[model samples]
Target: MQAVIMAGGKGSRLAALTKDEIPKPMAPFLGKPLLEWQLEQLKRYGIRRVTLVVGHLKEKIISHFGDGSTLGLELDYVEETAPLGTAGAFPLLLPKIESEHFLLLFGDIRFDIDLARMERFFLEKRAECLLFAHPNAHPYDSDLIVTDGENRVTGFDSKHNVRTGWQDNLVNAGIYILSRDMLRRVPEVKKTDFEKEILAPMAAAGEAIYAYRSPEYVKDVGTVDRIRAAEEEWRSGFPAKRNLEFPQRAVFLDRDGVINRYNGFVRTPEELELLPCAAEGLRQLNSSAYLAIVVSNQPVVARGETSEAELETIFNKMKTLLGREGAFVDDVFYCPHHPDSGFPGEVKELKIDCDCRKPKTGMLRRAAERYHLDLSACYLVGDTTGDIQCGKNAGVRTVLVKTGEAGRDGKYAVTPDLVADDLAAAATKILEEQ
Candidate 1:
């Protein structure tokens, strides 16, 4: 199938990284040009004709790909003289879209999803428009998409009919497969945003617009800090689908060792001690392109040693502390189960094995679903084998630190994808190439 990559838009938010020269799609990472990885991804997907809708820095993009001959694909360019909303670029590139069905991707987004399966869904459902929807993380981050049980597109985040018994929850992946006829929805003289003006209305009318669900690994490289995070994900050595090219980076922290002192069942704010450098690293992670998250197994709450409210209090304290430091924890997730402890309330809730707790990818997956982060492009920094396993399970890079709990080697010890002496060392390695 043909793939259309939208590479326009001045990346104003990424000014700190681009320094007034290029757009987000052109940001540098992993010693190679970021867009080069995107092109490579499409190549792996067997997309023969690749169309890049260029604006802002059309000349630079033109100079970079140079007709796509070496990339084993037919290259085409559609230059928009003015800033066109996402769907607006369509009319500009309509002439190049030659088939009944083709793919559309936002260049600023790097993701690893099953493209073949998505297309199969389109064909199998007989949909004129198939939008890949991911379980949302931040509804405000992008246009939200909701679909019915039959997979027909429903309402958006705003004014969604929760009573309709429809799965009005997922966010649009910004990737689509639309029939050539769908282009008719585009106005002949004006530009439009597909999400805002077209798809929602058509979906309301029962048009064949639908969604294909996938727990994809993705990233939006639209900021300087996010770009740094992406670079870190690449260097962390986590495993992910080979077809995607965007740099996906994340910082996974341990609850007791990294976030606070390793006190027994840190169940209360009074018991929590905010480490000095931890917030700095978190600040660095949040400021960069990486998703800064906390992945931990807090069995204390489940063991009857603490209450969920106490857990919240502890997290609230951490959140406030981090915010005061000008560092933000994008998300925090923990498991309350202990495999064989069976302590009581904590024992029962923490006893059963589930995928999300540390040593598993549940919490990581939750973050991925919310942020569209590519797991392979993510990293987990902890002090135990469970941390390494969790990173491995989620297909992210794992880093072990020696400054706190994960210092000594024992049965619970794990060989990390990378090891550091402290959070600063890990952060330094975050900026380094593997």
Candidate 2:
């Protein structure tokens, strides 16, 4: 309902790029204030009322956003009388956050989060706290490692508590959601962290702390190298995704053919084989920071050819494989309904023609609602005309892959915006345009 942005940090690490001019939150990327992009993302997600916890270079932020009028949002500030750590900001701004539960985001990072979904998830799951997390990037990525099955946050890595053999290689996303009452309990001591003190303690105490995985690309522009990596990533359109200099977009990807495999209907991992350069292509899109998604129609499940549990088995396998390869799906959407036929009992579950199936942007539209995605700037990638038609019907970009048979026939007269032999090549072209 309400959002609080931790925009007050000095961002000591990015001094070279900021020209000693502003805090990291105000630092420019592509001639736009870093905080502006964050504000825009909030607006996209239907968060019109926001509170900025400002301390370092607080004036810069206040002057730029000045009442948040231009953005059509009510903007307020928690001018910390003194510098408080990340966790402290929450308690300090608690008075201003009116919602029973609200969102917390670090201004230093650039991410595309689906807050609408997160809120509903928080309520339905009845969680006290929920954090966004992803796989640790490399040898020295800063994040809190999750344990207790991501249900309880068991550890914090400083660079502390880091040990090899960490299965998920998962790390804290620096994004958080907490109940209003949780803030009242926060200790008001000097110099505290949400990780070492709050989250870890809560988990250890058997609190309902949940870790929400992005399953896509989540980057923190904290270091010079990471900043460059992000810039390069944007320029190259990293995951074979299209680049829009100033366009609002939410990308839609076909599951079987475009994302994983087009082997008829993907029923199991045994039948699932990722196409050539699949991970790399998706990696490029991930880096470009698009809202990467997988939308598929698995009729086989409806036909009783496969079970839902079996479908999850396939996804679990795909998730591991993709994460290892450095390209992960953000959110996956599938339709198990089959209209025409079914196998015995399978028809009961799969008999209806649902709106979520491809050729209909229902799933895409749902994702847009949840993520605050701008579907008008969206793009859809598939290997069939149906995919193109889906994107067309959704009023977004439609691109076809020539690697499949759909491109062979002249019947596909709709003319895809960009045709690539493969996802990577197409992603490369999208990057070039950016």
Candidate 3:
């Protein structure tokens, strides 16, 4: 595989670190140049050939890593004489990118990702463009990517827009896998805004643009504070540990009673109100080594009380509300099936005894498979006996909170590994045990 990096930014925001002597890509990060770190990561992933698009301080970069042989990789440079913007220099690199699909990265960000896993998703979807998307701490102010359940990007929701509706916290994390055909599609790129001019149009045209969402470490270190934070994270081995190539640890949570107020079946988005401690609990998980995932049972869809679209809206409200409090879930998995078929409005086909319902381990097992998670090292936190039973069935630790039903559902004769007053206390207990 091959890679291309946009290394042209002046990084005025990082002038304190760069001192106007180097371009943003040449800014030192943990003693090495930021661009060098990116190259080393790409080389480790077997992407030996790299094309660097340089502009701001081109000479400093060329002088530092000329030919890239010192790094055991073949490197080439493309100097943009004028400011051509993000995708504007692509037209100049047509001859350099020979592979059917190549990786694209922004210069200012530091990331450790599973390239092979992402490549598999790219090839499986046969995508024209594959974006590296993830949930962030603040979706309320970030440009969000809207994708279907299959991960096909439908549209973009800019942070600048007045967002009256709820939204999922999928943000474009400034990393991408682009097909060679995409390069040709940029007809004489001149000052192109990649998101607004390039990707948005392709998405609107119904092209196969997919978002590969992962719970990995990818952050833009444009500011000094972020660089300092990244250094600490790097020293702690957080980035590499977050790679999907390794088995991950997660805290799977039940949605309704735990994260939101459980006042019977939530039939609409308006009915879904977040619990006071939900964000506090989730924020704790977000900072820990564990990935925060939600395994929910939304039988409303099966009972015909809510459509899948409305259920999505409910989840959107849940995520958006959490994001507002600087908290986010890595992913959400829900079972819309119900066993009984005697209801008046129920969807008969979905009224089957599915394996994913409470007391069954289908959802946890599926999450484990998808994320390469270690079920033994995971925990399931919920408010009902069914949740504890499901955790037991999945061979994971269970934490039953004293909120909502408080395990008084009486559906099962199981005990949780731990009990807490609410989600906040549960999170504290989980972290303390670790």
Candidate 4:
């Protein structure tokens, strides 16, 4: 596969590390240039041909990699004499990119992702552009990507906007797969922003721009502090572990009475409030190897008490609140069905018995499939017997928290593998043993 890297950035933010002697992509990372690491990763994913858009000390980069023969890569360069925006270099390289679809990303990011998986998704969706989107620790100041449940790009929310209500923690992680046809928008390529000029307008016009949301490790390590953190992450093997190519371990959490205050049924965003132990516990999971995923049973949708859109708002509130505390969940899976519903305004179609409800193991199975997780190595934390039963059904370890129902609901007869005072305690126990 072919790839284009926007390496023209002067990297003014990384001046301390670059010392202005080298370009940002040429900055040293763990004894090697950052661009070299990126090339190695692409080669690992069977991408041998790469075109680097170079500027601001371009000769140093060319001098180091030459033809990329030492690294088993076919490398070429496109030099920018003047400052060109992100998509500006595309017009100059129109004769170079031959593939129908090629990968594109900034030069400053440190990432280890399942590019094959992303490619499969891009092809499956017939997407014109596929963005690698994920939840981040700080969404409050990040430019957010708005997507529907189908992962279609709906809108772009700027960080400068006065975000009033709940917002999902979906941030574009500076990685994308673009179709060659999309490059036609850069006619003259005179200082054009990719997001603001090309992709945003295409999305607005109802184009096939999709967001491939994943929990993979794709972070911008442009600043000195971020580079130090990336070094530690690389040393710890966290980035590679996060890739979908490897088996993942997750801590499945029940929403109500576990992460949030159990107030009967959370019908509205205002009604959803995070518990005291939730943020700290999730933060611990965020730092650990375990992917923090939420699996909940929201029968309110079936009961007609709350619509799916409203329920999404509730989840958005949960994520927004967690992001404020430097914590975020990798994903959320909820069962909106309820059997034997004779309530006031229940939706008849959703009243059928479904396998996704608690004690059914469907939610865990879905998560396992999506993340390539090992059920035996996973753990589920919840406050009800139904949650424990679901974990048992899924063949995963279960931790019953002594909050909310605390297994007093008597909805199911099951024994938990471990017991904890709260979610924080549950996280500690799981981390200590592993």
Measured against the true structure, the TM-scores of the candidates, in listed sequence, are 0.55, 0.61, 0.98, 0.98
The residue-by-residue lDDT of candidate 4 on 308-337, one tens digit each, is: 999989999999999999899999999999
- Total clashing residue pairs per candidate? 24, 7, 0, 0
Off by over 4 Å in 3: none
Reference-based lDDT, residue 327, model 2? 69
| Candidate topping TM-score | 3
Q: Candidate 4 — number of clashing residue pairs?
A: 0
Alpha-carbon error at 141 in model 2, in Å?
Answer: 6.8
Measured with C-alpha atoms, the lDDT of residue 145 in candidate 2 is 55
Per-residue alpha-carbon lDDT of candidate 3 for residues 1-434, written as tens digits (9 for 90 to 100): 79999999999999999999999998889999999899988987899999999999899999999999999999999999898898998889899998999999999999999889999999999998999999999999999999888889989999899998889899999999999988887789588888898899888888999999999899999989999999999999989999999999999999878999889888988898999999999999999899998999989999999999888888999999999999999999999999988999998988999999978889999889889999999999999999999999999999999888998899999989999988899999999998
Span of ten consecutive residues with least summed lDDT in model 1: 160-169
Local error of candidate 3 at residue 268 (angstroms): 0.7
Candidate 2: residue 309 lDDT (0-100): 64
Candidate 2 residue pairs in clash (backbone atoms < 3 Å)? 157-160, 238-284, 238-285, 239-284, 239-285, 240-427, 256-261
Tens-digit per-residue lDDT, 1-434, candidate 1: 78888888688887776676766677776765667788887787788888888888788888878899987778989888888788886666678888889988887776666677678789998999998775433333345566554668776665343332222235676788989878777866356877779877887888898887654556777777777776777675532532223435567787677767775568667888876777777666654556677787887766777776577667767765655566656556778766776344454645776776666678887776645577777788887676776677778888888756674635454568788877767876876743
